[model samples]
Target: MTIKSLGNPYDGDVDLRHGLACNCSDCADDAGHRMKAVSARDQRTRMSTDDMLDRAVESAIVRSMFGHNELSRRSFAKMLGGTTLAAALASVLPIDKVKAAILDEIGTPEKTDLSVGFVPITCATPIIMAEPLGFYQRYGLNVEVVKTAGWAVARDKSLNGEYDASHMLTPMPLAITLGAGSTATPFLMPAVENINGQAIVLHNDHRDKHEDVSTWRGLTFGVPFEYSMHNFLLRYYVAEAGLDPDRDIQIRVVPPPEMVANLRAGNIDGFLSPDPFNQRAVWEEIGFIHILTKDIWEGHPCCAFACSQAFAETYPNTYGNLLKAIIDATQYASDSANRSEIAEAIAPTNYLNQPVPVIEQVLTGRFADGLGNVRDEPNRIDFDPFPWHSMGVWILTQMKRWGYIEGDIDYAAVAEQVYLAADCGKVMADLGLEVPAETYKSHVIMGKTFDPAEPEAYVESFAIRRT
Candidate 1:
């Protein structure tokens, strides 16, 4: 049998000549066949090693949990599903105690060498930097930080199992779980990578007109995705200025990478997009930063590290370790001292694929506003891994406000289930980070207070809302 060797321009030509007929005297007979066989055997050997390690970990858990009845416990676990077994154990054991035990005794990860998807934006600071910074490896995991094309692709890949986990918009998991734009599935956001990192950028021509947003009617704007903080904040900003976002102006869904080019080509007048695109526009002299999203709603959540609930349940230890890695990375990114180093780490082609200076400006928050003034706002972009349930409640209100989701929504229930605050809080506490006493916090978006208890009323409070 003749085997065709593969080659690419990036990797150079493949050597098809092997042994028997080989020109090199050091080669053995049919070396290529032996090499192929060895490669196949090595692949199986690696998989078996992981399986054996996982079984050993499970055996340890069974021994720890059941003492003398380890065999019976394993039998019961095999009969009932893992989820059911955990629930059954919780009935006998205090639920909180069981959770604490599980947290402490998390075993070998179910899966490693994971692929996590992200759009190359500053909001994904922790997830992107975890690769080069060795945070993932520190947690006994191997993670591939894949740079995706856009938010839609990222969401699709996540839903379809192409990515084990992903960097998603804060509202994406909620929307996905609720089946707003896609199939209904149980999605979970265990951590928020960064907050207040988005901005509304306007073409350089509109730099003079800052105060009166109402005067700029019929202008075109871009958002990365519909279920994104950028879209919600942009809508709130325009609606507050008495412009109906759906009717008054055109809001196009443009990927972050193309936002600056769209502005330069006159395809869009402006965009409410995640950095470093906003800073990229300024760096290229195409657009000016109009307002940071932080100014719209302080400490607002943006991009999240999300995975399916199925992924979490199937790989509990892997998920927990992944969360811990992200939490640690987030803590590191929160410090001002690490901002410059993080910017350099994530700016390469394999990650953000942007200029280092643009990434630095976005991270350090002292940037050229594109109006000839250097703004010094240190909190412009921040890393906080907590998945606050109140943030979920607000996003639901906005989704209902804009008519994306109809009918009565049990906001708090959905928020709690999808946000995974209890687990997130546990991880944060375990890491010695500050954990909020309550899962909910009231926020003021564009001068209007949003009470998590009264989401319906909050939607009604918006005069320019779709519903």
Candidate 2:
């Protein structure tokens, strides 16, 4: 007689509801025990050896329990606790308290003796300072801040694994991970470092024709880096004015301070730079301030905390600590009382390569926004620039349109791997932070509003943006 096959013995079977299946290798090997269990439950005194055994079922249950037992975490409370406001009066809050909170959740940071790269600070300088400031070390990482020539070098090193993670240009992590400039990586950028400190520096000679907003030409501008987020914003904003950026004007790459020299020397017509250069440019009479980068893509995600696919997978805890450190720095930066120290901290030649006055203007957001609006107001960088996936997805779409990725790529699925919001939250919660909503897009920053729901539409809305 032909034997009838049993279909998935433990799958939704009523008789098997009380029993685990014989899927365990150990159970399968124990034929004698299998026979005993089968015989014990037999309708007849004896059963065929072919009948499945209960010993096999018990083993499966045991293995499952063993698997679940391997899931682990450091305590969450230890990771998130900080008293920046409450302990502000103390001579030293000794970051250890915050570090302890982070470690309680993550155990230890991932990259010890890590050589992380950071660009010159405009706004995105803290990720570099956080290390020597003893923040990352306090959280259990022995980090070294390596300065690259600029954003492109930092990004290339990160991709080559010469550096663990970089204080990358807003789009570098996205572009590289999407396989834009090279091979695809599952890059991880867990938290916001800083934003709203960028500006469009006008030439010392050319008057900003806000009067002719639609057709202001003769601008050969300086971009900090060719493919940096600044380039993207310039493109989108120019497009909004119904101008073809590629055809209408000239775009060139120059370092921040070099912008003034280039403009003064007439090397370039104008430049977009971040502080202290932007601030100094205005204060030192280098140029008429054209616009704040914040004014263009207000609340735009500027710099992100990025790691490699290899680093993220291997050392999630370390990555989590890195996020906590950046968040802690943000909290410090946000307090009105802490502004002076933050400026001084980032100013020292050890960090941003700028003067305290320049760094202070940036931290304080005291720079002229170039639209007859001198914003001596709240810090513009958003601390909880969440729904990081939304940021990446938007970036991915821009990348794809620009031919950064070749074939059809799933931006949604890919973004999930890079940002790691779940881990970011865990670190925040562990440090006693109330997690903010993961945002898809931030519309208004420094009193600006973006249509968060439709970034693509917004991108398209810019009459000046190029295809």
Candidate 3:
């Protein structure tokens, strides 16, 4: 809500907007009169939101100190009302000086040494490459890229402040912020690390079933997390074929590393996961690639660079530097010429912990599909740091479609608040990358158009929505 929403909080002829108490017929008349007198003094002198909030705080402190007790303080404030007390405080208190002191330490880094948590997947390539490629150090940062066990651990570490930032799925920050699968916290996704890097892999025996999704009704599949693009996209793919995801099939949350083992042990038939695990499974002769996520949504975001909103506000300089490093690394990774070198650099024991060739195949987009067929697709996986706000809206639509979130949602507000598109655009523009002017972009998924402007209608148009 806007500051104007505080209207009618108290009954009086007082003009709260200009912080004046008067028994006038029209508050706007009084405000205009005062503004004319003030404008004659200085046109540039104006009250800011910070100044107003600080004045409120000072007023509370003064009331608490002078009143007889807590009940007496409440009675005193209620007796005078908002406008009267505000005017009384403005006469007695030095509000502007207090506001200036409160805001004195802004726009500087509170901490320098920091840790960033990431899962060992190609989706986190931008975050991982930032350290070795000197992007982090170039921006006056000492960053430690910690490889976590899974998304859960990464989320926990970030929530507990063990890591200053984290590599997260595009939807994790939204889910965390909404308290969908965790406690509510204001999270921010400043940049998307990689897009279209995931694929669906099935056993070799069921290769024919991949063509006809309806034939795979009773099959069990795996995804990396409950609030993941893999799960949502997989469900969309299957449900489009007239199969219910909740009843017609079972989708279990399995870490990317254990997907192949789960398939080999007959625990799951296939998994929609990130590479180099998908490439690893194929190289080990366990599973064959069924479809790449790019085939579903060519430029879909898979992972993001996320941090709590509190951290960003507390360390503005450090957060900007971090965004700079990530955006620079993403631009470097987006080029096709740098794929091989990146594969070699990240496919070590400390990083992805997989064979270099497997990582190479994933990065280069040329691989054996485990069905005795070699494929060459250059855009199999790509890196673009722009966290389009439309993508956030779409993810929330899916969350509502599958019952992950409930009730009415302000889709645009949530998307705009959580996804740092404006900040990302600034970084991208500084790096000489093409930045789009519009915050929302329309896309087609499974042959259905999703208009970000009307997310609710898009969710309702679905035949399989839980809502």
Candidate 2 per-residue lDDT, tens place, 375-445, comes to 77465443452436766666665654444455556666777777677777766776677776653544553
1-467 per-residue lDDT for model 1 (tens digits): 11111111011111211211222322344354435433344334443524333322332333346431323544655577556775775577574554345435555677876888989899898988776555564455556777798988998999999999999999999999999999999999999989898888999888766778997698999999999988988988988888999999999999998999899999999999999999999999988888899989999999999999999999998999899888888998999887887876677666777888999998898899988999999999999988889999999999999989999889999999999888889988988988998999888877778889888888897788878
Worst-scoring 10-residue span by lDDT in model 2: 68-77
TM-score of each model, in listed order? 0.79, 0.71, 0.77
- Model 3 misplaced stretches (Cα beyond 4 Å): 1-109
lDDT of 3 by residue, 36-73 (tens): 33322124543344432343334334433542122344
In model 3, the Cα lDDT at residue 218 comes to 91
The Cα local distance difference test for each model comes to 0.78, 0.57, 0.78
> Candidate 1 — what's its lDDT?
0.78
lDDT of 1 at 193: 88
Q: Predictions ranked by TM-score, top down?
A: 1, 3, 2
Between 1 and 2, whose TM-score is larger? 1
Count of clashes, each model: 0, 30, 0
